[model samples]
Target: MKTLGQKIRERREELDLSLREFAKKLNCSPPFISDVEHGRRFPSEPMLEEMARLLKLDVAEIKRHDQRAPLDEIKRMTEQDPGYAFAFRTLVDKKLTPEQLLELVNRSKPSPKGGKK
Candidate 1:
């Protein structure tokens, strides 16, 4: 799993941006950008939204990488309910490997007998 800093660095590089240049564009100090890229500091939500715009990444991608569930808690959850774990793992694996599920989800429409639209 890539860290938020790693993702930020990668995106910055992909855009051919120097740290100073990126910082200038973000209207923040270079040291702040450095801290964020080195994982010494986390960006605020508004800062993250700015990064998403400048880097052309979805805000959710940055947020997800930045905030992660602790591994120990995840392990405990899986241990407490193996069936839930299995189902979750299966869904994630399918999500990664196939487009069918994604397409189905994206293409889903309101049912004629719907309770909610």
Candidate 2:
């Protein structure tokens, strides 16, 4: 499980892009990019998308290492329906294993795309 910084730095080096060059392409400062690479900070969603495109990596791959809570989204969901809040509380109280969580998600309704469950 490589950290986002490790993945980005490795891919950037593999593509022979210098820090300044990568930053220039991303329209961000080199220092900010350095901070992200050193794990001092995480890139925003839009920035992560751009990095994924440039590095030929999936956005989800980078996002898995984000370490930031999706607090805004969670708050919105909980406000929209109390069920979401209850579900979250239950999950925290039970301290469900990651594997259990994935299994639970897998048992949910199929996607709109009609993909297999």
Candidate 3:
């Protein structure tokens, strides 16, 4: 579970690019890049895309390290259906593991005409 900064730094180093050189190529300041590598900041979506290209890494790999919660989506879901909020609370109360939760979701999905898909 490497942080985005850690992944970026490692990939950049593997490419033999200095911090300053990488920053120059990204059209950002070296200190800004340093802050990102130190986990004090995150790059914008466009910058992340360029970074992925420069490092020859997948955009999904960079996004996977984004730790920000989808707060807006969560709020919208809870507001649209209070049942969602209750379900979320129940999940927290039951302390269900991720695997168990995924299993529950899979079981709840509609089956095919004669059997499960």
Tens-place lDDT per residue, model 3, 15-46, is 99999999999999999999998899889999
Candidate 1 on 1-117: residue-level lDDT in tens?
Answer: 578988999999999999999999999999999999889998888999999899999998887677445678878888998986997688877766435665766676767895335
Clashes found in each candidate (C-alpha, N, C closer than 3 A)? 0, 0, 0
Model 3 TM-score, 2 decimals: 0.76
TM-score of each: 0.58, 0.74, 0.76
Using alpha carbons, what is the TM-score of model 1?
Answer: 0.58
Q: Where's the lowest-lDDT run of ten residues in candidate 2? A: 108-117
For candidate 1, give the lDDT of residue 82.
93
Residue pairs in collision within model 3? none
- Per-residue lDDT of candidate 2, residues 1-117 (tens digit): 677888899899999999999999999999999999999988888999999999898998878767667899999999999999999999999999977988988788687897655
Off by over 4 Å in 2: 110-117
The candidate scoring highest on lDDT is 3
In model 3, where is the ten-residue run with the lowest total lDDT? Answer: 108-117
RMSD of each: 6.2, 3.6, 3.7
Measured with C-alpha atoms, the lDDT of residue 9 in candidate 1 is 93
